[model samples]
Target: MKIKIIKIVLFTLIFIIMLSCITKILQPKDDGAIYGVRTFFAQNNNHNSDILFIGSSHIHCSINPAILYKEYGISSFNLSSGSASFWSIYFYIKESMKYIKPRLIVVDMYTINQGAPYPPDFIFKRFAISMPLSLNKINAIRMEASKNVFHYYINPLVFYHERYSELNFIDFLLYKGRKNRYKYYKHYIPSVKVHLQNEPNIKSIYDVSKLYYKVEEYYLRIIKISKINDIPILFIVAPYVLSNEEQRRFNEAERIANEYNVPFINFNLNYGDYNLDFSKDFRDAGHLNDEGAAKFTRYLGKYLKENYDLPDRRGDPKYYSWEMNAKYHDKDIYNIELKQYTNLNEYMEKVKNADDYVIGITMLGNYQKNDRVLQSIATNFNIDNIYLKNASYVVDNNKLIYSSDGSNQYLFHKEIGSYTDLVIQNGQRLSINRRNYIKTKNGINIVIYDKFTEEIVDNIYLQKY
Candidate 1:
């Protein structure tokens, strides 16, 4: 009897060791925060976020929190996922609130589709796994277990494994470094140029009835939570190059917004005056590029300033980090140049005289900083230009200026004190101190210099007209 008991114990020990080996093999390598799992976890723990924007990829690509901060002194973060559903939004919000108490919540209505045919289970799974904390992990596990007990228990190997099969060993291995991890409280400011245009097939719409029901539940939950926490919720329908079906979805969303007593801004219908170029402004058909985001954010900032009683966290030491982030993200406006005009006076005169003209202003890669400069210029200039090219440029005092670029020539105006560097003969070259600028076969290179240091800032490529 003693020998038999020992044999049984030894066999059990060996089995356990084998299981452990298998588990380790399946376990994901932790490289750093860029890893999807790590990024999700790190973002949830971000404490400096004062406003949380949640939705699908649309929310992530369109709303630049750093831009918002730069313009209005509002701290915000984007808590969105690709192909995110209502359940995902809800869980993200629930998890996010644990780390930061936001002043406002912006919920994009794109995911509130009522016609999608897929089951909510898949959506729930996606969101559940995205959560990083232990409590959220446990909650997600329980939820999954209740629905698929066999998969949860019998398939332990499969259940515990990370979902990113596309990531190779190197990718996972690289993420193991602590430096690769995302800074939990850090804010990202986008510097890439964005273009806004109408997407092809601006009339397609999809029925989201089933999806709407699920979304409705989450929306109500968010509203309830916001009310209890004294946080205001703003419902925004991000503009996209839409099909007829998608346009219809916005109409339905408007109806739902009224029913829910939520303030809704449907940019698709309201921002007609902007005459956006969807192709240039979007990363895809649905998501805005940096340029589009800047335009939309500027509109939002002005709207908030005019309509809402939003707090300006500027100069408040408690929000010093946010302020610093904004400043750090701010672009030096002197560098931006309008490649189309030959002289600052000419550009200003064209801006004052023309009913419509395209203004192309290039920034030094920071979207938020560019937006602030553009806003300043827009507020100050009387721009009647038809197509505003690039992401950042503003009309002021009946003259258009490159507000975000830091080049001294662009900042100085012969007539109006200082304006953007002049583009001679289209984009051939800029006439900084020179009056007659010419473009070579290789094209005109407008080299802008710094003001205080006199260092070469940036070169603008222009074509001779």
Candidate 2:
């Protein structure tokens, strides 16, 4: 019996070794370094952060660390991922706390909704690569690690393989062999362009019963962990496109928030009175654009100043990055162009005064059928020695003429017809043609196109003017 027991122990050790070797072989090619970097940051004692924000894309894009430092004098870092789950959040917080002692923890509560499931791909990748052998990570790993060793070990396809495809090796080499940083906000800004008037009345995309149970279990565990660690927890619901079902989910979240004994700040519900423009402030229905992020950050800064005891760490040399980041925020010249035109009259004047420009007309839905609006703008802008470039699409009847380059491709199914609508007012047609184009739309719209030759990129919209 003793011999058999010894043999069993030896077998287990050998199995573990083989598993570890296999995992490395099948690991993701691109984001493998990301996991390594995250682990390094978590374990390293050199860098210390005061405030650490963790959550999904909402946390990363919405919370600008520079803004926090500049406005409140509080140093912060956003350690967030797109579609991060409860398990991921718990592990991330655990790992991060090993390096940084945060005064406050802002937890996004959107993950609690039944509709958003814990992303298994990310959780598995994080577990296999970076997750420590502690009780927490081990438990999580054990729960997610595939039972089929062959699938886990030999199949490189099982991992997040697409991440490797997206890598730009040139960019990576230029940046000292580090992977390119994913731009969380490509164009949009976070701001309260639309206000939430009444209690959010959202409908659930998932089954209410199942979602409530899962949320309760996950939330309670998080609360218990925070309580034991003496960490102050702030629950936040980031802004998103809301439907009746989503509003219902928020209602459920509110109940859980009260029970958890944490401060629940529903930015989605509270920002109604702020008069937010949906186009200028959001990158998508759920995420904020840069402008939106600034507004949200300012509001959050004010909130922290009033309610929290967070200290201003601006003068400290250790927080120099914050200052640098703050300076870079204002370098975008597009914001200046937007401020110059408050109304259509001002916009028209600027267009008239320009020498050479490109005019792009975007039509929504069926607007392409009626080219009245864009035709009129084209006629009005007709001047000698001036260029009038026009692109039109159908959105029912309203033809919108946008002055930009032809390269601005739509991401959705919008009929974008690029044509130079010349109005010969003073004999010479306006020369509205340019090789370079600046994006005017605030939000990121997904353009659909033909699969084979990649023809006709549609659904592109303008950024904030």
lDDT of 1 by residue, 292-362 (tens): 77788777767766766667767776666565445433322222333345654544443344322323333
lDDT accuracy of residue 4 in candidate 2:
100
Q: After superposition, how far is residue 12 of candidate 2 from its true place, in Å?
A: 19
Misplaced by over 4 Å in model 1 are 1-47, 114-126, 133-146, 149-181, 184-212, 273-275, 315-465
The local distance difference test score of each candidate is 0.52, 0.50
| Residue 54 Cα positional deviation in candidate 2, in Å, after optimal superposition | 1.4
lDDT (Cα, 0-100) at 56 in candidate 2 = 69
Model 2 Cα lDDT, one tens digit per residue, 425-447: 11112112212122232321222
Structural similarity to truth (TM-score) of each candidate? 0.54, 0.55
Global local distance difference test of model 1? 0.52
